[model samples]
Target: MSSITMVQAVNDALREEMRGDDDVVVLGEDVGINGGVFRCTADLIDEFGEERVIDTPLSESGIIGAAVGMALYGLKPVPEIQFSDFIWPAFDQITSEMAKMRYRSGGQFTCPMVVRTPYGGGIRGGHYHSQSPEAYFTHTPGLVVVIPSDPYDAKGLLKAAIRCEDPVIFLEPKRIYRAPKMDVPDDDDYVVEIGKAAVRREGTDFTITAYGAMVAVALEACEKAAEQGWSGEVVDLRTLLPLDEDAIIQSVTKTGRLVTLQEATKFCGFSSEISAIVAEKAIDVLEAPVKRVSGFDVPFPYTLEHVYMPHADRVLKAIEGVMTY
Candidate 1:
């Protein structure tokens, strides 16, 4: 095992996968020579040369379109979209072409590609660089949405996405990209199964469900709540689409309460879906109404970025409220 940050773990996953598979290639603006904005693809161009580590034009649509073409040609293309906030331009290409290729072709063809992008706030990047738009992709039928909160999951889940037969939206939380280092396994085959929720903390009071950057915030809130004589369980929903409904129901039923957190807009977000699922499956087990701590409905702001985010204080308050309710 080697201690590394989430960024380094991602770099390792890409490097390891590319070394193992001849068909695996990475393409994005600045991903080749510049090694990506976060350096996740750093040194890859030096190792794999220009053909495998490609630098494309500054166009999200073109990047994804080319990746889809490569996927159809039996090449595993991992397309980087720079930032989640900039992924809208490629929405049609992603949700329409890449997502529907297999189903529209009626099982004869498969689009095996991974769309990687840095998402969420905390770098002080205004609206254009920071946004949690996982919901839009998760609503699509053929896409798998994944968000890793730590270095281990970042490496393992990425390797799994690369080997998957379907397209995957791997959203890296830019906020915790570097910090919270861990001793990640150096094995190239390490893979955290997709669609499973990891329980970060165990408690009987209430359950806190979150993913990506919010998982750390959920753990922080659990720590604060612990000091107040309340215990909260933290469940990291690593995969958003094929959600681990069993884990969520089990946690909420054990705790008899639920408090969800998300860095995206509060209204009609992924947290809403989680709350609904809990209500449907574990209604009798819940002691209090589900609570959601999330970002404001307004656009992501520059000056008020911290205010617009859901911090540990916000999550702790929600946890305490649900425990007492």
Candidate 2:
């Protein structure tokens, strides 16, 4: 095991997969020569050469289109979208082509690919660079949405996504990409199962469900709640699609309260989905109304980002509200 940043672990996963599987190829703008805007794919070209590590033009649609073609031809292509805010240009290709190939083709062909993009707010990226768009993809069928909070889950889930037959949208939380370092497993074979939730802390007062960058914030809130004579259980939802419904139900059942956190807007967001699930399946066990601490229903701001995004204080407020109710 080694203590490494999330970005470095991402680089480790990509390199390990590329070395083990000849079909695994990476392509995106600045992914080859520049090693990606965040350097998640840094130094990959030196070991894999130009054929495998390709640098494409500045076109999100083109990059995803080419990846679909490569996947159909039996290559596992991992393409980066530079940022989640820029993925809209390739929305048609991703939802229409890459996502529907398996079912639309009667199971004869499959697009085994992974689209990696940095998402969420924290850095001073304003609106263009700090949008949490996982809900858009999660709403689509036949696509797996993954968001990792730490180096261990980031490396493991990424390796699993590359090997999976379906297309996976791997959203990297840029806020915690380098902030928190953990002892990540050095073994290349270590792969976290997709569609699973990791319980970060065990408590009985209430439950906090979060993913990506919000996991850390949720944990902080849980710790603060503990000081106020309340215990909160925290669950890190590693995958949005194929969500771990059983884990969620189990957590909410034990705590009798639920508070979900997300970087996206509250209306029609992923947090709403979790709230709905708890309402439908575990309503009898709920002690209070399911609460959600999320971003406002407005564009991410440059000056007011700290207020716009959900933080530990906001999450703690929600937890306190649910506990009191």
Candidate 3:
């Protein structure tokens, strides 16, 4: 085991996978000699050379489209989008080509690729640099959406995504990329299963379901709730597309109250999907209406970035509302 930052853990996973699998290649703008904008792919070019660590032009569409082609031809491509906010140019390619490859070809074709991008706020990046767009990809079928909150899950889940037969959208929370350090397994075979949810904390009073950076905020709120004699269980949704419905339902059933949290906008966000699941399946066990603490329905602001994010205070307020109801 080794204590490292989320960025280091990601680097380790990419390095380990590329070393083990000759088909695994890393490509994106500034991903080669420049080591990516966030340095997540740093030092890879030195070890793997330019053939495997490619630096493409500043075209998101081209980066992803080429990855799809490579995947179809038997190469495992890991493309970096730089930032979630800049993934729009490649949205059509991702949603239309890569996602539907398997089904559209009647299982004759498969794109086993992983698209990595940094997402969420808290880094003072305005609208252009910071955005939580996981919902857009999660809504698409045949794509796996994953967001990790810490170093351990980040490394494990990323390794799993690279090995997955389907295309995986790995959204790394930039906010906590270097803020917290944790002991992550250094074993090359270590992997966190995809489509599984992790329980960060255990309680019986209420449940808080969150993912990505919001998992930390939810855990902080749980600590405050304990002071008020309310115990809150926190569930980290590792994968959003093949959501662990059983884990969520089981958590809500025990707590009798649910509070969904995310950094995305309130309307039509991933939080709403989880809230709907609890409402439809666990309505009988619900003690109060399922509450959601999410960003307002507006563009992320430069001056109000902190205000726009759903913090511990906002989550705590939602917890109180649901528990008191």
Candidate 4:
């Protein structure tokens, strides 16, 4: 029961986990002494000392590769890639090495590491700093993909990710780092289970599904629709991997229509997976075709960022279209 910013929530999670478990260590470029490029790791170096909280060279591969070694040696190392767009250089270490180590070694070696990176666009970071790379890791087996929309989930899920015995790609929507405010649980151990979605609003018209920064947009649209005599249920999908199909199916069953939104490109995005689930299992219950309101299927541009990310207007328009059908 304490209102805090998303950045502060993340800091709390890291601090709590590091104090709770001696095996937990943080590694990445400028994460220690410099406190990260985004300042998420601020004051951590002063609190945890250099051995447990480390700052390395500007190399993503080196960071991931070293985490793999550390994890195999019984240390839970969490690495932060300054931006999601810059994780490509470490894709091999993530997808090929960290992800499959436990499986290849027959549970003899577990890569319990968390790769955190800021994703999505709204701060005019263009393409290099705002790519949503969750879907990329979602496609890779043995990797857990997670995205939190608010302060509470950010703190809870980060603690859970640090404890889980797998490689987790924790995507933090940079836009909402300081945007949404909520009173997180005051309990010392308030870990939210990954893969569960939160219903932000309750309605029977349709379910607007979203995650990360887009969750706030969907909530805003739902509020506006309520003022206009329309009702819509808003779902905040906290995790991307090990998805809770039961919750999604239950929401769509009640609403009879579903609209999915994301900040990433539309083609083969996370929405595609959710839509396929509804089509495969709940087609008869759907009142209308499941629609996707997402970023255009093209490289994100600096000049057209507003056009690239889904906004409340697009979400409401999609809701209106679904209601008509």
Candidate 5:
């Protein structure tokens, strides 16, 4: 086992997968010599060569469109959109082309491709750099969305996304890239299955459901709530789409309340889906209305970045609110 940052774990996964498969190719802007804006693809250019690890032009649409073609040709292309906010340009390709190819073609075609982008707030990145766009793709049918909170999940989930037989949107919470570390197995073939949620902490008063950067916030909230005599359960939802509803239902049923949290806009974010699912499946078990504490429904602010991101205080407040009700 070895302690590693989320970014380093991602690099290790790419290196390991490339070493195992000759058809795996990585392409994105500045990912070659610049090593990606977050350095998640660092040193890959040297190890995989320019042909496999490429630096493409700054066109999100073109990059993703070409990746679809590569997938059709049996080449596993991992395309990175510099930021999740920039993924709009490729929405048509992702939602229509990449997502529907296999289904629309009557199973004659498959786009086993991965679209990776860093997302979520913190690090003082303004609106353009900090949006969590997972909800957008999660609502679209035939697309898998994943958001891994820590280094171990980051590495393992990325490898699984690469090897899956369908298109996946991999959202990395850049905010916690280096803020946390964990002893992930050093095996080069580390892989975590998608569509699963990990129980971070177990308690009975209420459940704190979160993912990505907010997982840390939930953990902190649980710690604080513990002092106040509230035993809060924390569930790290590693994958947003193909959600582990069984785990969610079980947790909510056990606790009788849930505080769904995320760092994205509160209007139509991941929290909404979680809240709705609980309402439908665990309605009888809920002691209070599902609570959602998330970013305000406005563009992320330049000067108030910290205020815009969900914090431990906000999570705890919601937890207390649900528990009391």
Candidate 6:
């Protein structure tokens, strides 16, 4: 095991996968020479060379369009969009081309690609950089959505995503990119299965469901809830699409109370889907209505980012509300 940050673990995953598979390639702006804006791809160019670890133009659509071609030709391409906020330019390519390739071709062609993007606020990136747009990708039918909250899951999930045959939207939480180190397994074959939720904390009072950067906030709120003589079972939803409905329901059923957390806007956020799932499938076991703690509906603010992004205090309040309901 290695105690490493998420960025290091991600670089390790890309290196390990690229070493084992020659068909796996990474392409994005500054991903090769500059090692990405967050340095997640540091030194990859030296190891894999420019051909494998490609650095493309500052065009998201071009990046995705080229990845779509690469995938169609039997190569697994992991294209980073620089930031989630900048992904809008490639929305058509992602939603129409990359995502629909396998189905449109009737299984004759599979788009084996992973669109990696850093997302969420907390880095003071202002409106142009900070955005949690996972909901948009999650709504796309043929795309697999994944978000890892820790170093271990980040490495394992990225490895799994690269190996997957279908298109995958891997959302990396920028807020927790350099979070406290964790002991990630040294094995190259280690993989955290997609479409499964990991329970970060076990409790009987309530279930606090979240993913990506919000997982940390949820855990912090859980700890605070414990101080208040309450227990919150924190669930990290690593995968969004093909969701682990059973795991979420099991946690909600066990706790009989639910509170969802997300850094995205409250209206139509991924948290709303979780809330709906619980309401439809586990309503009989509910001790209260599912409370969603999310960012404001307005565009991601610049100066008031701390106030806009959902944090431990906001989640703690939702936990208290759900428990007392």
* Model 5: CA > 4 A from native: none
Misplaced by over 4 Å in model 3 are: none
* Model 3 C-alpha RMSD to native: 0.6
| Pairs of residues clashing in candidate 5 | none
Q: Please, what is the whole-model Cα lDDT of each candidate in the order they appear?
A: 0.93, 0.95, 0.95, 0.89, 0.91, 0.91
Which pairs of residues clash in candidate 6, taking residues 3 or more apart in a chain or in different chains?
Answer: none
lDDT of 1 by residue, 273-309 (tens): 9999988888999899999999999989999998999
| Residues 13-128, model 5: lDDT tens digits | 89998998999999999999999999999999998999999999989999999999999999999999999999999999999899999999999989999999999888777879
User: Which of the predicted structures, 3 or 4, would earn the higher TM-score when compared with the native?
Assistant: 3
Query: Per-residue lDDT for 25-52 in model 6, tens only?
Result: 9999999989998999999999889999
lDDT of 2 by residue, 87-166 (tens): 99999999999999999999998999999999999999999999999999999999999999999999999999999989
As for TM-score, the candidate ahead, 3 or 5, is 3
The 10-residue segment with the lowest total lDDT in model 4: 179-188
- Cα lDDT tens digits, model 4, 104-170, are 9999989998999999899898879777877888888899899999899999999999989888999
Q: After superposing candidate 6, which stretches have Cα over 4 Å from the reference? A: none
Clash pairs detected, candidate 4: 1-186
Model 6 CA lDDT for position 310: 88
For each candidate in turn, the TM-score is 0.99, 0.99, 0.99, 0.97, 0.98, 0.98
How much is the lDDT of residue 185 in candidate 5?
81
